[model samples]
Target chain A: MATTSLTTETGGFEVRRLWTDERSRAIIFQLLVVLGLALFIAFIVSNTIANLQRAGLASGFGFLTEPAFFDINQRLIQYTSESTFGRALIVGLLNTILVSSLGIVAATLLGFSAGVMRLSQNWILSRLVTAYVEMTRNVPVLLQIIFWWSILTELPKVRDSLSLGGAFILNNRGVRMPSPVLEPGFGWVFGAFIVGAIATFLVAKWAKRRQDETGQTFPMLWVGLVLIIGLPVVVHFILGQPLAWDMPERMRFNYRGGFNITPELIALWFALSTYTGAFISENVRAGIMAVSKGQSEAAFALGLRPNQTMRMIIIPQAMRVIIPPLTSQFLNLTKNSSLAIAIGYQDLVSIGGTILNQSGQALEVVAIWMGVYLSLSLLMSGYMNWYNKRIALVER
Target chain B: MTDQAFHRQQAELLPQQPAPATTVGIVGWARTNLFSSWSNSVVTLIAIYILWLVISSFVQWAFIDADVSGTDRFACTSDGACWAWIDQRIQQFLYGFYPAGETWRINIAFVLLFPALAPWMFENVPGARYLRWFSIAYPVIATILLAGGLGLTVVTTDKFGGFMLNLTVGLAGIVLSLPFGIILALGRQSRLPVIRILSIVFIESVRGVPLITLLFVSNIILPIFLPPDVALDSVVRVIVMVTAFASAYMAEVIRGGLQAIPNGQYEAAQAMGLSYWKSMRLIILPQALKISIPGVVNTFIGLFKDTTLVIIIGLFDILGIANAMVSNPDWLGLSSETYVVVALFFFIVCFSMSRYSVHLERKLDTTKR
Candidate 1:
């Protein structure tokens, strides 16, 4: 009763209860926020409409039918200047996917090897790899792209091209190699390859069950490889060698009649893989270190050699930590491939820019890019998150 | 009798013997580290060879046969790097097209950066309590000094290019995004469902897309959304977009910090009858912000490096200037030399900042080791 302080309290009407009430304040704040967002959206839409009309810029995706009229230097599918803008955009998208997929494969291999080297017992090897990782990671990848492109373009001209046993040619233009040309009866070999793949899968399932039941191991890896490869080769011989090589031959101006990998593609691929590989190496190292030394020591105590300990104990545990960051690194590499535009690699953003300029439909082109990248990101993270959860340690 | 004999010790302990010749000092170290086994020996030798090959060729091309100074193609006839262009156009690379006479203004602004940043970065810096006020006012001071409006000649933003442009965008984005990041982070943590959901959607959508796409939006689509009468500066547009892009990632980083704080602190503040804003400001935020310094610095480094993307949008950043200089008629081709210089600049800046973040992490860490 003595703690009561009526005199110190504010007069009854000095402040309104509505502002003082926490629940009421929260409701009011949220309502105001909703109203503000609605008004802002309304404003932007109205302004955009008025501006688009006044500027006389065409809207909608109808312009997709219009001829691109711009020639792309490299393409996976058939493309000509007369193709529609939509087709051109698809071509660019395919090229981006091609580069990104190849870069991912290369980066993972490089990253894993570099990661192992960084942790190696040899001091010089570890230090050398560490220095490389730091240098590659800290520089802007775009600079590397430009650097690699310059080096590639500075290769000897067609007149003095570097030859690889008359099967491959390298010059300022690009790398030219024998492209596979399939003749009649190739379908039989292809079918045999498919059949071998199915057989291998069934045999693997059977082998796993057999091992569980009998405690005896089958050489599954060797058996699968033979089935997949040997079957196809044997079929090819029986069918009189249906696959032929179209070797590149030098022409007066340029090399023709071979599979050509452009300097642009190689430059982009090299730069992206090396740069992203640096980051991936760091993640790999962190993942490895996160596994306690006790795990490896225990493996050794159980009579495992160094390589066996690393393989049978360390690597399996480290993968749990490695995978999530690796996926994000892959995503970053994919997004960074957009920088291919700077070097005229004709990636999605590059072609989209051209389409935006030609059609003056800035909104649509930007939307398409945002939609594609955002969806791709969501799909990958979703899939990875599920896999990560499945593999995640079930802690008590 | 056996025990009595065993008890006798030598008057002089056996003179301390040196280790075996093959197992002592540097030789011993090398044996364990570089030649522990047949495989290790092979690996070390192969690594040394590869390292020698890379280092030798780089040094030869970059230094031994490189040209140092001249005005045109005549300056660089060597097969090595033509550093003549970099020497002559160093100013353009550093300051862009900002006028030569006004270079001192940019210099002062950058010089002032040390003082401005010191107090914010280091609490015990000399006279930090006073210097913090200066830090707070630094943006205005830098702006006035760089643009020159108050009793000084004006310099427009359009004249800005080169590395200066990179700093302009990077610094402005760093400064402006902090508050938005904090607000968004708090909103994501808020009890109000509407606010929480809105923040989540904004953060994820921004995080999902790449910076280049957003830059495209800013470059091509943003102007259309604004009223016809109002024109935004291109640099301002870029800064706004960059700030927005960075703010999302910053929100996530700050959120991690916020989540690290124990719930006990929040309840204690509430138990003391402190209001929501007061509790956050006086208690929750200080601790959260302390934990977030390393992440913030890392994000800044990433954003700084990402400023190179502006080159693709036609801004004449340092890389852009280098590209232009290499293409200049006087300097027909020195792409390698120019790119190397630019890459070195980014490497030094980014590498140092990353080192600083590591330092800050060590300093701020209070968890029991």
Candidate 2:
């Protein structure tokens, strides 16, 4: 009984000592940091309040509903000078999304091609790709943007525009393509598109499951394309051809009668895509290199054809290495989209700047920018996390 | 057995014959590198043809046809690049709206800075250990030269928004940000909770937003927080914002370096009875910095590139000046030429830095493998 009591008492003492140990010092340090942060925040808050009061300016987000008097040059959504600031902001957001999506697609395509070429046995092709990557990436992207913009702007005026096979026109105004106008039965065609999309997804799932069960591959891409494209066309014809083309025609002064993409948007998109593509190309090359040569040789030994091996064995593994840095490039592209304002593409920040100057609501506009950007970042991080989890290597 | 040995000798001799003369020298290099196969040869010929076509035209336009000096566009009708516009606006491109007579001040400042900076970069320089303080002092001297407050005519920050201004802002941001970044990185890694939490918040918040948004906040909102009577210069405001942004990125890079340091070094220092600060200052930082030299250089390169973003805030860095130069009616169609020059300038600077970083990386590579 005496020994047991002594042991219990020792255990108690050890627990107490652990609670008061150097590791606990970290907790104390943490507490002090929290306190310091709190104090600093309080100081900033009070100082801000004092300054705001002195400036005679009220702070809040009430300005969002106010009419935005400024006109945006290029907007995807419907917007006007008399639209609410909130609506204008939506336009900016849409523009940002549109440009970013296009840039991501273009950059991915170009980067992947260039990256693969850089590792090619063909010395000329590889060196050319290397040269392109090095030259484009070393220079500031903004300079490239300006360069492309200048090139676009330097093109002959509308009257003397370069016509490509009489279907498209290249001029200072921008590239003009024939746009399709939806007619009365366009709703039916749109419904068909949705049905085609669902069918394609279902087919893809079935194909994947079939492959898993039978080890027989189906041409899923070809099937999906046929359904998505052919079904839409068939439905459109059944609905009495519910679209009309608005072809561009060169007039006395300028080209008219087509959906016009402003030169500013074209310039910004071209620059962002080309510049980001260069970096992404390097990342792709690195990822491909990171996949050891033994893997390729092993695949070859397994009797797989070169293309099949690359598609099935190499690319999947390479993608796992590529995705993380690729995500960063995506983020960079998104951020670089703000350069639209330089060429006057009227993105979110530019619109906010306009609003701030007009309403003198600097504090509110800044808060909105911060909140929007932070949320966007959080969303991106969340997506990245999901992607990472999906592609993560599972080890036993 | 003799006949078999002779046959083997003959096979070896056949393999040892000299290659054809056509398969050596520049021609051989071209055949191998540019055109090893039929398809490859076709590609090479086409590439050469296209290159020749482009080069001849460019040469004729840029050198033969282009005007080198004139006030108006009328002098430049050559099929080549119009270099006259560059000649006329080169000063504005470099020093943008700075007092014409006082342009010598910038040159003088640059001359002084190079010698001071060279010693820090070169291993042969004497007193290399004390040169750390020069990094601090150089910016101060540069600011005085640019801003002109010390018994010199005051050039306002609003007027300081151009190409040279961009370089100054970017360089200043790098210098100021690095020390702050080192401290913050240390703070984040520290056992102290308060410092870590503060560092986390600062880094996350700054890293979360775009630089343009930060510039907006600095330009518009920062003034409202300060006392109404106190007015900070716009350039100063921009510098502070840039420094804050750059430091956050630098902190992450430095922390990566710090984390990579072996734990035994710390234990060894502690066993020697050196205090925490001493151990960190003398042993930890030097090693960590060496490991992170590439990362730091990359950050500097990124900072330099990002300096172009100041154009959104109405500042004219090299890119901004180029843009402005292009917009002039007299040089309206000369944007491509101007941009090429600007790109060349940036490429030279950035490429050199990257090469230097690679050199440093090789030098500092201490891994056993």
Candidate 3:
């Protein structure tokens, strides 16, 4: 083809040939794109520098060391108003991860339940699930957050707080629950718990091997559960009962001496979980539906029980369809946690907003947010990709 | 004797009768769908009880026991919602502080949008082809009417709020994103390495971050990036940011559509002596976009929802205005009523869009036919 093209085009230098040739045209178009992009970037950079200088703001990481001097109520790390901006940002990041992780767990559980319920044999239940999903999903998530926040904050104040027999306390301040206080000898129990987990893995592996070799099935699940829980209990007792509870008591003004979860965290967590769960339910439904009915029939033909069919056949196949979209839902939850700012939940965005206001380093603050969020996105996608590869179907 | 006895008695075959009442109609439906088993009956009863509880309370709070005419928080009772707040501020909710007399301009814009969009939305309607011109001209006309640039009282970006603002931002993001998204998708698929990399980077980086940060860029950093004299309207900045964010997602959706097209189409176009641009324009995109209608609509729904993020940066769209109303001293503690109203509005829009997408999917299901 190359020889024919060269020989045919050798008669004379034809201007029309230049226009007709695809390769030359492609190169020219690409060059134009590159040039245009470069020029645009240059223009923006020049403008940015001029504006920064004119506004009398130095653009760099110098502002990060300055004191944040802003209060954050729902931080995971130790953070004070006197903390540096960098420390405050870290606190914010930790809070983001905490909310996101907790939301992901709750959303997954709720979503899977709802998704399965939507496909249930009962007509009323399925329709109710449908209504729940549609109603929750259609409205804006930010509105849901604000709505929930308002509802929580409207609860009666600390003095008139509602309680569940001195165990769980609820008020406008937040929910106070009895905190588990681990005593000195609890380390032995924790160690035994880890050992039990390893033993469970070994037992499952051995059961599968035995089943493959001799056609004998062992109840690994029951054994594993017993081993894990029993071992922990045995160790705890042997260590002289190393667990105690710090029950929240109603003090003069408020509950004291227990875990005090702020209203902001509760509201944010509930809103994010419920909102993201709606979308995740759709994904779960689609994934389960993607698995053909034949697979379950085949499992039954092989003498598998209903529970066995789901665990060994249907769920494995359904997961292949579920994981990809489920990853995006997880990432979306992480991103949506930024809405915490609307309800005064001092998340990464809220803290960054404060820092931007205080330091006048809008450029750097924005960059930090983008960079952190992008890295988080990349990391999540990478981990999900690895998981996908592990569970991927192997074809010969 | 045996042979005579063997004269076979004719068998009496009775006509078939209808099934029992318990096995037909509503009774049968209930037996099978609701009370097939003990567990099912329990679930059905539980569902009914829950539904009754929810509906009764909702009706009581939203209608029967509600305050519909009172003007302030003091007039509201804790026993029920005060819908009167919404009724009183309905004008502000629909047309945020756009001088009361000039609200007709917004109304005109709102009324004109359907006729413009109808040609494209319902292509089978008669005379749609001729009305395509209206769709083309509507954006400019609506902008002129709303912004009041051509010999009308000018309304600045700050004055744009409420549902009008939501419509403006959402519509602009969706309409502007499509063409740009298509370009980016095509660029990602292009043979040129430079263009492919550029498209990938733009798409990924934009999609990576939450939209609130992008709104921050518009609010705080966008001006710094532009030349000193060219101060962009904040509304325009938001529109631009939303378009950029949405186009990235749109590009991925369109790319999925593009990938579903077999390579034979490309080869066939090449064999016809069609240039790359010509083939993409005439042969490729039309078919790809036809397959992508549902996905595009989904992206539009998501973009519409994301427009609420603009409120985080102090731009008062519907959600923002609702927030403002909640915080207002006169309307304080009426958050539930305001939220319900706002939620209903959004639900209606998003739900209809979802249903329309489903309908379109069925309509375009050529494989079934």
Candidate 4:
């Protein structure tokens, strides 16, 4: 009775309880955290300002408009040393996008093939694929880049460059390939091609519906291919053969008048694709494995052919597993394009480095780099998320 | 009645015939795996052709026609690889311009690394527990050996290059990021909104940018944060940035491990009347860390490869040293040999790590059973 009275007699909650109470403790800790963070940020800002003042450098975006005195070897748009830094950065950004897109396409094709081959019944083929994936991924990509660059550069000089019947020329400078020159009437051919694509889409939808309703499949693949390619060719001939090839011609010193892809681009693209391809193949293999054998067996039991089972049952499930990680791979490829600096490919990071060196505005350049990459990452993730949702299984 | 009679007669056993000759031994295995269908047979033939072509060409270039001996570029007569370039500069590849006499320090560090790493990696080995202390002390000892403090002749950070620099940066990044990663992982999952937000911001931002940009930041911007008189070594700066970048990735990997832990485990720990930190320390972290081993190793491999990026910002890692060697006037065009050597070195390390992780995964897969 005395102990109970002593506990009840205290007007306020016990000081120990207040300190130990999880809720109150959490609140107090958070407050202290907020205060500490504020102090830290303030310190950093003040320090930066003081350093900037001492260095006699004003910080802003005004430097972007200043003339860039350096010339770029490869530009997607018209630009010279007279161009502004902003234009140079834009050119760099485009080059980065170009390489990343091409790399993604090549890597996906190679990776998917290798991934499927890895699971092939042929022992030697599977082993070879495994070797490729393991060896390619383990080595540093920069080494691969330098190696490719050196191989291309070591090619015999322009005079003795390898030629493929005057259609293509290979030299240390670049591979000169025949460029397609489209005439005025090619627009009609292109329009016909677009029409063919739309027709194929409609036909495919009809075929799918027919397959569902009557259990009858159409030759959609063959028909679609014919419509797209045949229709375009027919339109081209009817319009008097509007497309012509401007073949590369060997000259006194080098090839001229064609699409000359520089060795730097080739090396950069090859290294990026092969390196990223190994990783993508692993993802693809894992995705395929994640779907149990029972799924294919079930489809087979339903009387579907092997190809049909793969197309309708297995691929859909595997794609769900593949896409999220695949998005990260694409982002990685985009980021790795910056290694172009090592080979002088002039991607965004490489150009930014040049700008930073010339202007001495490290802060602004870094901020720009972080901002551009963050936006790209976010955009890719957003699109992938939407795609993932579309393919997500609907529950009962 | 007829069906029953037939079944009884069939059950009266007959001797099973041997499998057909085409369906036995290696022949049978080949038939099923490589020629089960027309398409399969076609693919098999094509694969064999491609494989033969590649192997023959590689062998011809690498062995039959290659010049492995005779000192200089002029000695290379065959139109193949010039491995003599690598043979000549093997020392530079292993230890980029540290005073030749100090080479013993690098050798000691290299020899010590495996012994230090072994106990931690294979904890179940006999007497491993006794050597656990050595693992903790290894990094400090290695730094002192490399940098030369405490009465030893000091080697400046710039002199630290080649494969040694790669190991230094990779090991430091991977080891130092772990504890910070755990904190960030926990913070991201915290009940407090501010802490969670901060963690998310840090992880996302770091992951968003490329390692190159981050390296640039360390090289260029870090010095400005300190007073003019205080100069930070470039190697230290780069290591700090790498650690920060790696921790962000590590946090996400750990978060995956954390999420995999069922709610019941957390509830059971809480129901025992243990406080948050105590319960987390004793109950949560061990399980989460155990589950995170594969992912952590993958991150380690990535960080190891990324250590080569330091070359872009002017540090001489293995790739940088190799790149420099390629530009040597004597070895003007032996880029293939130099890069191949670099690739082989990285491949051996990374491939072994990947295989070990796979083995760990297999060993750890006990829950299904």
By TM-score, the better pick of 1 and 4 is: 4
For model 3, residues A1-396, the per-residue Cα lDDT tens digits are: 643242344565555555466776677778998999999999999999999999999989987888888888777778888989999999999989999999999999999889888988899999999999999889998989899989999999987899888899989988999898999989899999999999999999999999999999998879998889999999888888999889998778777888988888888899989988988888888888989999989999999997788778977888888899899889999999999999888888998999888888998989999999999999999999999889988889
Candidate 4 DockQ, CA atoms: 0.70
Fnat per model, in the order given?
0.88, 0.69, 0.93, 0.75
lDDT of 2 by residue, B83-127 (tens): 887778888877888899888888888777766677666677777
Off by over 4 Å in 3: A1-18, B1-11, B149-151
In order, what are the TM-scores of chain A for the candidates? 0.91, 0.85, 0.95, 0.94
Candidate 3: pairs in clash: none
Deviation of model 1 at B149, angstroms:
1.3
Per-candidate DockQ values are 0.78, 0.50, 0.85, 0.70
Indicate the residue-level lDDT of A50 in model 1. 98
Best by DockQ: 3
lDDT of 2 by residue, A307-354 (tens): 788888888888888898887788778878877777777888778778
TM-score of each: 0.94, 0.87, 0.96, 0.95
lDDT, model 3, position A364? 92
TM-score, candidate number 1: 0.94
Count of backbone clashes for each model?
A: 0, 5, 0, 0
TM-score of chain B of each: 0.94, 0.86, 0.95, 0.93
- Candidate 4's TM-score reads 0.95
Off by over 4 Å in 4: A1-18, B1-21
Question: Residue A24 lDDT in model 2?
Answer: 55
Candidate 3: which docking quality band? high
Between candidates 1 and 3, the one scoring higher on DockQ is 3
